[model samples]
Target: MPRYKLTIEYDGTPYAGWQRQAGLPSVQGVVETAIARFCSAEVTITTAGRTDAGVHASAQTVHVDLERDWPADKVRDALNAHLSQAGEAVSVLTAERVAQDFDARFSALRRHYLYRILNRRSPAALDARRVWWVPRPLDAEKMHEAAQRLIGYHDFTTFRATQCQAKSPLRSLDVLDVTRHGEMIEIRASARSFLHNQIRSFAGSLAEVGFGRWTADDLQAALEARDRARCGMVAPPYGLYLIGVDYA
Candidate 1:
C-alpha cells in the first residue's frame, strides 16, 4: 500500500465539523466520498486536527493509504474535480506521497489557529460568517497583554469544554497573540494540542478586556480560578480557523 498526504482547505459553513457522521455532511465524509468516486475504494483518512462545525481551515493535513499507487497530482486533481462536481466548498490544495511511518495526526509537531473579529459599529457587509463582529470598540493591545497570561503550561480547566475528552487539562500553549488590522482583530494560537474549546474560550474572555468589561488582572484571575463557571464565553465557530499544521 502507498500512503499519500493531503493538504486541504474548506469553508466549513455547511458541514457538521470534520469527523464523518452517520448522515450529516462533514469535511471527512465529503473528501472520502470524492476519493471513492475517483478511485472506487473504501478509504479512511486521518487529520492533524478535527475542527468543529463552522470552523474553517486554510491548511489542514490528512493522510490516506491507497492500495493502488497513483500520481500525487492526479490524486489531488481528481479529488478536487469530484468535490467541485458535487458543489462542495472544499479543495485539495496539495498531495504528496509519504513514508508509511508518517502519520498525519500523530506526526504533527504544531498546529496553528487564527480567529478573526470585526470590530466596528457597522454590521459585516460581506464578511459575515467569516468573522466575529463586535459592534463596540475593542482595545487590541489590552487583549494582547491579557493573552500573555495564558502563555505557559497551566491547568486550563476553565477553558476546557465540559464534554472535553482530554484526560488532563495540563497543556503548554506556545503562542497566543492578538493583533489589529483596521477593522479586524486577529487572534493567533499555536500549540501541539489544545483542550476542546480552549482557544474559543480564550477569545470570549479576551473580548471582555477588549470591550473594557474586564482588565488584565481579571483575566489572570479567571485562569487562576480554574473553574469553567468563571470563564467568560466561547466565541462562535465561524470566526475560528485551523490555519496551518507543522510536521517534522
Candidate 2:
C-alpha cells in the first residue's frame, strides 16, 4: 500500500461542506468519488482541516491510501480529470507519495485562516461572493487593535460554536492579525487547530470594533466573560477561507 499526500483547492460555494452527506454535495464526497472512478476502488481521505459550507480553501492538505502504488502525477491528473468531467468546483493541486507514518490530521502543526471584508461606501461588484461587504465605513485601525487582544492562550468559548465538539475551549492562538489595503480588510488567524466556526466568529466580533460598536477593552471583556452570548455576530461562511496548513 502506498500513502499519497494531496494538496487541494476548491471554491466551496456550491458544496454543503467538507464532510460527505447522504444527499448533499460535499468536497470530500466528490474527491472520493473521483478517486474511485479513477482507480476502480474505494479510498477514504483524511484532511488537515474540515472547512464549513461556503468556506474556501487554497491549500487544504489530505492523505489517501491506495492498494497499488501509482505515480503521484498520475494520481493528481487523473483525479482532476474525473472531477472536471463531473463539473465539480474542486481541484487537486499537487499529489506526492509519502511515508506510511504520516497522518494528515494529526501531523499538522499549524492551520492558517483568512477573512476578507469589503469595507466601502460603494457595494462590491466583482468580489461579492468572495468577501463580506460592509457599506458603512470601518475603522480598520480599531479592528486591528481589538484583534491583538485575542492573541495567546485563552478560553475561547465566546467565539466557539454551540455545536463545536472540541473537548476543551482552551487553544493557543499564535496569530490574529488585521490589516487594510485600500477598500479591503483582511483578517489572518493561525493556530495548531481551531474550534468550529471559530475564525468566522472572530471576524464578526472584530467587525464590531471596526464599526465603532465595540472597543478593544470591550473585546477583552468579552473574552474574559467566556460566555457564548457575549460573542459578537458570527460572520458568514462565504468570507472565511482555509489558507494553509503546516507540517514538519
lDDT, each prediction? 0.95, 0.94
lDDT of 2 by residue, 117-138 (tens): 9988888789877898888888
Flag regions of model 1 displaced more than 4 Å: none
Cα RMSDs of all predictions? 0.7, 0.8
| Best-matching candidate per lDDT | 1
Q: lDDT by residue for model 1 over 76-148, one digit each (tens)?
A: 9999999999999999999999999999999999999999999999999799899999999999999999999
